[model samples]
Target chain A: MTYFAGIDVGSLSTEAVIIDEDATMLGYSIQETGADPVRAATEALREALSLVGVSREQLHHVVATGYGRINIPFADRKITEISCHAMGAHHLFPDTGTVIDIGGQDSKVIRINAEGRVLDFTMNDKCAAGTGRFLEVMAGTFGVPVQELGELSLKAQKEIPISSVCTVFAESEVISLIAQNRPREQIIRGLHRAVVSRVWGMAQSVGIEGAVTMSGGVAKNRGIVALFEENLGHSIHIHSEPQIIGALGAALLARGEIHQK
Target chain B: MHITRKEYLLEQKEKGRRLMGVFPALYPREILWALDIVPAEIWDPPLEIRQAGAHLQPYICSVVRLGLELILQGKCDFLDGFLFPHTCDSIQNLASVIYDFIGARKPCYFFYHPKIPHGHTARDYYLKNLKALAAELKRQFGPLKMDSLREKVDMGRRISELLGELYDLRAARRLDASNEAFYRTIRKGEYLFPDDYIAELEGFLTQTRSEESRNGATIILSGILPNPPQILTLLDDLDVQVGHDDLLNGSRRLLISNEKPGDPFEYMAECYFHMPPCPTRGSSISDRMRHLLSLINATGAKGVIFNVVKFCEPEWFDVPNLQEELKKRGVPSLVLDTELNQGLSGQMKTRLEAFIEIVRVHRESITTKH
Candidate 1:
């Protein structure tokens, strides 16, 4: 059985997905990127391969992606996360024509054609306000885990408005709101709204195409997804492990590379 | 074989050539050359913003800020005069600050080339401005002899002809030069004496033009200047060639096509009107879009990259509409907001790579269909 692997080394975390010739995903692993991308990518790929009881030598092809993709010495190919997300999202949800990926430090809205090829894409320009890092910093300011903020925001009776689009200024605003004894859930929901508001502008630039798919680590946040859905006036499709989508796409691309040869 | 701009200017000064520090966008260089003054364009000068910040607002672009800083730093002490073209509001305000507030010891000349309505009145106004500028330059430096002006105008035409050929070669994929090398050769015209610049361009054309076409993803660059040249170097690394450009400091200023060359002053005015549509020149959005599409069609470029300088109001205003137009036409475009002289960030690199990937995909789809 021929095996293929894709590793995505992102700013906050690294993920690896293993698949076979048939493009069926067999196993995956996600881990913090920390300071060493090479080590993270290696360990993630090893863990993913182990999950499927496969050896590194058995893999026919390997593709690397994300911010630290250039750091991977063993990658047969390095594709950008933009194209990977589009292909991965379309593969899972065949009807998907648009993809919204809010990663650690950047957020991008990609418009894909019927063949899962990227038609157009727009990303936040050197700003973290519309990205997952913004939510993580806000969660830290609230002294809550990043993962819990989403669920906590769902309980908000009324969301206080977050007017600052800058991450630094927004953090200070959250601090001031906490000082004013504002409801924590309300503030959390407001932060989510800020993120959605920022990304909505990008989505509008590319103009959402057909059914939208949400990928990247932030897509796992139920509150953010719910806010995006409300903003779009339609539900978005999200994979159970959304963070692995980039790697899955890379893996599929790797499999395609072999066929092309 | 190549010397720095400062070094070349110093050599020319030693050779007794008077240098006029020229500001951005449109200007009558033939007049300057005719008056025995070399125009050293002052766009994107490499300088830290210390004294300039105290004078100009933070909202001002780096092109103006760096120009101010270059002057405030006393780097233009060797310059004989300054010419401020009416390109944009910030540059206009910077000229006022230099002439009125800072009291530049050197003579300051302002040329308000007519924007929009490039009709009879605009031409008459441009011709009048050209004569006024020549008169002012004569009073400051020397006399504007007619024969000298005629010869310089011819030289200007020759330079433009050569530039057009060079651009045609690149668009046709016959130029075997990297993006960095091509821009480096073209930007020499900013400071070098026209004769010297023409020689350098000829040498580059002879050396780099190839019978065999080069292979790579071709794209057009639209911007004020390709500063932080690391972007070009990055494109070189990625095997992406800048097939053509509409940059203010580049084709917008250099690619002057003049059919009516009967008189020197009239030819200069005609050249100004014939420049590629630029927002700084008050070019209409539709005109700029048509020009961009024409370039893409001529070069067979799969994408357009708007490498805008940060805080540039003129470029900032036109980008959204231009990008929308390109999108509607099925050409992928990327907007990169960059500061002058700053290194390319990792995020910017990723964005550029991703855009190239999309362009490659577009190329493949077209190829498969054909």
Candidate 2:
């Protein structure tokens, strides 16, 4: 079976996925971006290839996506993260009309047409306060592992309000709340609420359509996903491994490239 | 002393020097100088009250519209080339339209500077831009002499030093000239020869120290690039002296010191980095706002006028935040949208007059109680 390879070298992580001619996922891998993106991407690709038992010669085409996509010299074609996210979200759930992606450093809300084409999108790259980095910092302050934040926050008795949207100021506010003996769960919930509020602001800018699909690493945070659902006043459909959506989209695009050739 | 720009153009034509007009601060001045072209800034569009509306949309920023109006009127006939930088999206699209439609005769060159700030990658990108610009200049204007480029750089450095001193004097309120006169002097210096303009500024500075003002409200004007003269003229007409301004044309371009100048390209990148950044330059709106506020307090200004260009996203995002911050400090601010018309001067004057009157009444009440 001929296989297509897709690599997504994101700011915080690297993901690779392999798919067959019929768009069946053969194998996929995700790893943290340690120091060098080139090394991380290579490692992720190797891991994915080992899982599928496929050699490099079996690959029909290679596609890359995300901020570090340009650095991947081996990729045959590079696509924008916005386009990839929209395609991936549409592929997972055909009814998804909007995609809200909150990554490590950037947040984007894309409006997709019925044909899964990105009609328009808006990105907030200038701030890290509403992204995954924001949640990571808040989790660190509360002495909670970042992975456990979402589950613990769901147990909060009351929703506490976080007034500061800035990451640095919010960290100080979290410390002050701790000194005041505020419950860690409530504060974490409030942190999620704040992040959702900021993302909602961006979503409103692009006129967010319903049937929104949440993608990127932040989608794994159940606290943030719940907050986003509440703030947006609609249910959000998330992928099993949301971070791999970009790679999946890239692989699908590579499949299309082979057909065109 | 009172030569019209038309007359100056005629003289340049006689001397066979190609006059190329550029706008605002970040244009590649060194390249133009090396090409032996006279770099003139369209600080104010020479509008005749009739043709402003047909050429520019009222919703657009006046400075940009005025620039368009100037090109439409054929006032730029003497120019051989125009260099537009990717400052804002509005100006970028404007440059595109002018290059395709309006700027028919003059060859227009545009540069896309990366929007990222304070990152090593961005700095390296800026250095790459310098080399690219140098190569473009060589292709367009033949090979340039290193000695001549160094000479021009030194000339620009000296002029910047003089401009910085002028800003210092204005900040201290030691210069006795009206805000309009001071702004015009600087505007003229930007238009004329650097060394000659410095000599003229030195003469004016020496003469102005002894004079005194009877009544004027010290105010700070904050904006992206206040190159047009109408805003300053309106402030002057309303008896409001601009104690400090944070626009690119005013203080942002003047803050670069020439102390460490070795490689010209490196110097250009360093200057771009160290120059007082505009709100549009990065994500640090709070830092820029704080810097402007500190300058305002240092100058003892009573109010601020945020002259924002309409439809300019960066400035639009910044103004509301700055206004809220300034209000927390009990400082009142007025945002005026720039339109490319001579009539805007009157409207601006009325706004300034009202703002200054409020400041006066506020001050009087405190003085009476004291």
Name the best candidate (by lDDT): 1
Residues A192-248 of candidate 2: C-alpha lDDT, one tens digit per residue? 888888888877755778599989999998988988888777789998899998898
The worst-scoring run of ten residues by lDDT in candidate 2 chain B lies at B339-348
Cα TM-score of candidate 2: 0.54
lDDT of 1 at A31: 93
Error of 1 at A147 (Å): 1.2
Which candidate number maximizes TM-score?
Answer: 1
Candidate 1 local Cα displacement, residue A67, angstroms: 1.0
Q: Write the per-residue lDDT of candidate 1 for residues A1-261, one digit (tens) a residue.
A: 999999999999999999999999999999999999999999999899999999999999999999999989999999999889888998999999999999998999999998788888888767788788898899899989999988998999899999987999999999999999999999999999989989998788779989999999999999999999998898999999999989999998899889989
**How would you encode candidate 2's per-residue C-alpha lDDT over B141-218 as one tens digit per residue?**
767787777777777777777777777777777778877677767776556655556677777778666445335567
Off by over 4 Å in 1: B258-260
Each candidate's interface RMSD:
1.0, 21.5
